[model samples]
Target: MMDILIHWIREVDTDIRLGRPPLAGEARSESLAVPMMLQCVTHELLTLDPSLGARYRDIQEWSVQKALSHVQVRRMH
Candidate 1:
């Protein structure tokens, strides 16, 4: 599952780099993958130490926000 997530992430990143919006199917998959990825990360962090979950969730949230901002900036150009 991690491998598949990574592959999708990379595919999306590549499309962004090339200044192309993802195809409809890819965009749908990405919408699904992001939340699933966050859940997986949260679960793993909880397994390691329950106290880490909130902090890690915040970090993931920030990371996603930053990525979106970057994409928006790219689109402006």
Candidate 2:
């Protein structure tokens, strides 16, 4: 579990590094819309049962996509 979490953290850090840094005027408190789900998955796997963690990953993806679409719809209005 620790190994996987470490790997995820590395991937997230790499994503941030490869992506553009935020604009100077932008807020840092608000997270990037896309990777927020990754963060959620990280949190869940950290706390949830190790045996069920893989299933949690599947659930996390579905939940994040649903939430993201809802947010997108609101933004489009």
Candidate 3:
């Protein structure tokens, strides 16, 4: 179920935010995959039901921000 997966992802995100250990064998550092996956899932759900966009707007923003945090701005010469 997508709901179950979202719940689990949110739980792990919360744990990571609080500096707590993730599930056994899971990486502690922030992984680009985490937010990317959430964004992908959210996009798919929104595509299925347009009305759900309102409910997931916050998630969309949050995932976008999370994913952006991985970007590095470089000054190349």
Candidate 4:
């Protein structure tokens, strides 16, 4: 389950990097919405399984930071 969630998160990160729309059913208020979405997903996952929260902390942090950087760059352009 952890592996699956990690893989899905990576895919979402890639979609964000490519400037693609949110995965089919995902709701987004703006184009650069991955960071917020990722944060929410991370929080929910931790809530679901507190034991694995620590294991995913680094990934959640990195992905959110990366998405934020992308948003900043886009805004500057």
Using lDDT as the measure, which candidate wins?
3
- Which stretches of model 3 miss by more than 4 angstroms? 1-3, 11-27, 75-77
| lDDT of the candidates, in the order given | 0.53, 0.53, 0.76, 0.64
Candidate 4, residue 25: lDDT? 77
Candidate 3 lDDT over 1-77, as tens digits, reads 76666666677456434345557887557667877888898899889898998888987897899889889999999
The segments of candidate 2 whose C-alpha lies over 4 angstroms from its true place after superposition are 1-46, 73-77
- Candidate 4 structure, TM-score to reference: 0.48
- Looking at model 2, which ten-residue stretch has the lowest summed lDDT? 9-18
- Candidate 3 pairs with clashing backbones: none
On residues 15-63, what C-alpha lDDT tens digit does candidate 4 reach at each position?
Answer: 5443455668776443346556667777888898899787878878876
> Once all C-alphas are superposed, what RMSD does model 2 give against the true structure?
8.4
lDDT of 1 at 2: 46
Residue 57 in candidate 4 has what lDDT? Answer: 88
For candidate 4, the per-residue lDDT at 46 reads 89
List ranges where model 1 is wrong by over 4 Å: 1-30, 57-77
Instruction: In angstroms, give how far residue 42 of model 1 lies from its true place.
Output: 1.4
Q: Every model's Cα RMSD, please?
A: 8.7, 8.4, 4.4, 7.4
Total backbone collisions, model 4: 0
List pairs with backbone clashes in candidate 1: none
